[model samples]
Target: MTSPEVDFTRRNPTARPLTDKERDALDEFVDSIHYSSRYNDDHYEYRHVQLPKQMLKKIPKEYFEPSRGTLKLLWEEEWRGLGITQSLGWEHYEVHEPEPHILLFKRPMNYQPPAQH
Candidate 1:
């Protein structure tokens, strides 16, 4: 008989909390994957993340349909805090998915963030 597939998103039942050193290492790794500038310019810093087919399959079917608005909504959700302005923010940003399951995000590197409310 075949064993059930593992769901990676769920933490293992016997997992232990990260030690201080491990936490620091994880933080450094996260920083390394954050926004990176493609070109030396005042305009933008870019970053991207690729979703594997398994993860993409978990999303709703409508999100993958051929609609510009639906596509933008997906981008918006992925880019909520990166830098896009909605009602009260100074910085502007953009998102693109040039390839299936690949999301590219860019935001101005020179602009100051909006004041806290």
Candidate 2:
């Protein structure tokens, strides 16, 4: 079966297209994570284990992984951390970090942004 495609535009309808460097960084960041994907008829689901802080150092600072408070808000609001996903073209379905050094992320294949006028 074919891998699910990332609908970049759907991540943020009003956002501009990603620059080559931005795309490269995002690809690198995504690749660094250990992840697994499962596909159901409706959508693809992904679970990504957190990368070490040192590994994330190369990524842009704006995309700081997630703070505990931020993770709480994301769970309470059913929203992803925009800072982390802003350039990645993805959003978190769930986030759990039992300890400071360990984190787990769940994300759906599609990211649907609000309609833009």
The predictions' CA RMSDs to the true structure, in order, are: 15.3, 10.4
Model 2, runs deviating above 4 Å: 1-32, 37-46, 65-90, 99-117
Candidate 1 lDDT at 115 equals 75
- Best-fitting candidate, measured by TM-score? 1
Lowest lDDT 10-mer window, candidate 1?
83-92
- Candidate 2 lDDT, 23-78, residue by residue in tens: 55455445445444433334544444455454434433333334432122122112
Local distance difference test values of all predictions, in order: 0.37, 0.38
Candidate 2 yields a Cα-based lDDT of: 0.38
Q: Point to the candidate with the largest lDDT.
A: 2
Residue pairs clashing, model 1: none
Write down the TM-score for model 1: 0.41
Tens-place lDDT digits, model 1, residues 1-117: 222222333212332333455344334233223333344244454455444434344344444435432222333432332222232222212224454554454445564677779
